[model samples]
Target: MAGPLAGIRIIELAGIGPAPFCGMMLADHGAEVIRVERIGGRIQATDPLLRSRRSIAVDMKSPEGVALIRDLAKDADGLIEGFRPGVTERLGLGPDILLGDNPKLVYGRMTGWGQTGPYAQAAGHDINYIALSGALHGIGRKGEKPVPPVNYLGDFGGGGMMLAFGMVSALLAVKNGADGQVIDCAMTDGSALLTAMTWGFRAAGMWKDEAGTNLLDGAAHFYDSYECADGRFIAIGSIEPQFYAQLREALGLTDDPDFDAQMDAGRWPALKEKVASIIASKPRDHWCEKMGHTDICFAPVLSMAEAPEHPHNAARGTFIEVAGTTQPAPAPRYGGTPTDAPTPPPQAGRHSDDLLGRCGYDEEKIADLRKAGVIA
Candidate 1:
């Protein structure tokens, strides 16, 4: 608790995926996010998504457990849940109930669909959510099925990150004397918002509705990946005229008329073929050595194992070791109140006694609740 959100406490209704991800982000930035899991529940310790948070396990269906959460909610600045629309209300922990007690609390609801949409209660995942948001429609190669970006767009980007932003924004509102509010963070809505720039491109007639046919979507020869002789790949993003000129100079294609007209979209496929052939003649390292530090927008497409060891990543401390696991560091660096390295995730209910003590329960009262199987 050393960063901007140091004293802000968040009560998380234990859940999988984006909800937990949101909690992890808040916890990473110095929020005291207390995770309330069901009795005997466990979130895999290796999942970095749950890092830096303490947990309490309780029988959420029991009236005692419901009261336990309500008790904690009385002093929390916010609450986040990823259950389907009505699940929290069913648990009697919905915004109306919690906000009634804590008028300044920011309540964040993460879901695939929103609270009152027709598909609000439907079962869905990242692919389905982005598909409905029109994000998936323009994602793949022409004549190919849309490839899912492995849950990044809808789950983390849309759902978890959006929920975190919404929660902090609401907290700022509370600081400005606004009452507590509910944030319906639907993946569909978030995904669509994430496509705002592309939507603008489409509106301005600079983008195509079809997949793999736009300037930045792998259609342009200078803005795509090329295979190397070693079968590895390198990415090229020579989008600007100067960068494209540097690309031509680096590859000795300056004299070639085929590459001279870099903006001719119709000639992209043939130019891409010629460029691919040239790149495939050399290994990935060869191109890296030739243009790695230039304005050519060139870099080897490093794999996960290689990414952390890269010089830039190492220099930035972009990845860190926690519980013997290497994962990304807390991001959007703070200047005055920098975040501390996150602690490893604790076992569920590891701080049950300590957390309960802060909630006004004495040792004897907590022991009785533990005896009655109310908390673990």
Candidate 2:
């Protein structure tokens, strides 16, 4: 049986990062996603993360190619694109044109700074977007430079995921008789939205303005990583008094009065040092054997390779092997209509003919476009 979003159709204007990620999400959940690639097929071949979509390379600069995309959009339920402001309009495949063809189509635009901001036209990367969103400012250790959390915070987490959510939400609204509208999913805006809880804490006088100086930000001695004797890492999150007491007993730290003040900001550094010294006296394996599966909230810091093989993750089938590479499976397990990974990642324009055919272009039209260099 098809997945829950079986009948949805999405046209993805291929770019990099967020746009492809959004398309992958839609395709994984049973949407028929057609990736409109550039004529030269400007995408890497080994990106496993870009799996689960059909591709059609077209030269959007050509009138015929633009017409072909407009034809595809006529029947598409949604359209996702990640380009600078006015790029799609200039290509003549903007929301106005596509939505004019399909009034119920969800036009989802993914970008770093958004469609209409001072930095919208400025060239920026994931770091720049998250930085401006106040996410980077609250991420690292106090008195140290802000750490870029790779591209996860802005690119995939905020930009692509939010775009997918907006597209799905708009699709639902359209299904319920609402007219489709454009979804401007900005990484900067989404990243800021991701920090809504922190903002609430700040307003409630429970969160400090400084980075790594709050309970969940690694300021509290109870919530941080520690090094073991074998040089491996362990994470601890004994936040509540009961859990802290359990941790103290488990670690033989009952006699340490300094450790008793769980919320003493002035004593955190010393407490952390003491905890580090105790943890380092034992190997990671020893600590795991001692406190694994307890209310102490303890765990060994496993690497990416170790995570898939981890007992908990393995039991839950959180990762799967695809195309000889291990990657995370689609998440948020369903009880009835379960999700499944699609076919392996295709080579650029691998499905050009098939995708064009589905878009209502006959074999002769496809040959004409190919012969005219309008499509690959």
Candidate 3:
């Protein structure tokens, strides 16, 4: 069967980072995502991360180009953009225009701060956004510098994924006859939403404000990564007492007095030191063999290259080889409708003529736009 979102048409204004990632997710789940590139074309070649979308190059500054996108929006289910606020409005492709042309269109806007906040127009990156959301403050060792979480927290997880979800939800609402609305998805807002449980913990006095001083944030000896003798790392998440006991028995750490005071915040540092020393005595593979699939919640910290080859991931088909690159497969599997990898990312303006034709532009008009430099 076709994927769940098959037949849905989405227009994606080409952008870096989260916006493209969100488009990729939509296309992966079977939306026909048409990426609108700038006239000169996208800067990068087709890569695994940007796979599965069609491209149509257009000069949005030109009146004809703006009209072309407006025409496409008239028939599109959604439009996603990552331009700073007012950028799209200046280009004449803002939500008001698109929604005026098609009230059912779901206009999804993504940014680091938000559409209208104190920092909305300020320059920032993942770290800045997550920092303001209280995520970065809780992410590192007590006295060590806060480390960037590889852009996972803000960019992909909070930004792109949240935009995709908002667009989908908005589409659903419009389909049910609700008026189309703009979804302003800020990485800061989404990251804060992601910390809902942590906020609860803080309010209940279960979580402290300090970094690396909480149960799940490397404050517990039983819930952290340990570097083994070979320099490879293994992660442990033995949160429950029973799981902790299993972890202790598996690692022969039951006799250590430090392990006994599992929840004593004052003793965590010492316990962590002892656990680290014990773990460093063996290689990561040894720990994997000891507690691979048990309730101890243990696994070797596999690198990107090693992850695809992992037995569990391989058995579950969680990764796939595409265009000579191993990338994650479409996720959250559907029982009945199987989702497949889409065609490789297209060259810029590759589908300009075809897409224009689909939007009711005659051959003559398409040729005219190309000659006028409105459509590449």
How many pairs of residues collide in each model? 0, 0, 0
Best by lDDT: 1
| TM-scores for all predictions | 0.99, 0.97, 0.97
How does each model score on lDDT?
A: 0.92, 0.88, 0.88
Please give, for residues 258-335, the per-residue lDDT of candidate 2 as tens digits.
787788888898888888899999999999999999999999999997999989999998888777777777766678
Q: lDDT at 192 for candidate 3?
A: 90
The all-Cα superposition gives candidate 1 an RMSD in Å to the true structure of: 0.9
Native RMSD of candidate 2 (Å) = 1.3
CA shift of 168, model 1, Å: 0.5
Query: Which pairs clash in model 2?
Result: none
Error of 2 at 311 (Å): 1.1
lDDT, candidate 2, equals 0.88
Name the 10 consecutive residues with the lowest summed lDDT in model 2: 41-50
Summarize candidate 1's per-residue lDDT along 1-376 as a digit string, tens digits. Answer: 6788999999998988999999989998999999998888876777899899988988888888899999999999999999888888998898899999999999999999899879988999999999999999988887799999999999999999999999999999999999989999999999999999999999999998999999988999999999999999999999999999999888889999888888899999999998899999999999999989999888889999999999999999999999899899899789898998988888989888999999999999999989999998
Superposition TM-score, candidate 3 onto the true structure: 0.97
* Candidate number with greatest TM-score: 1
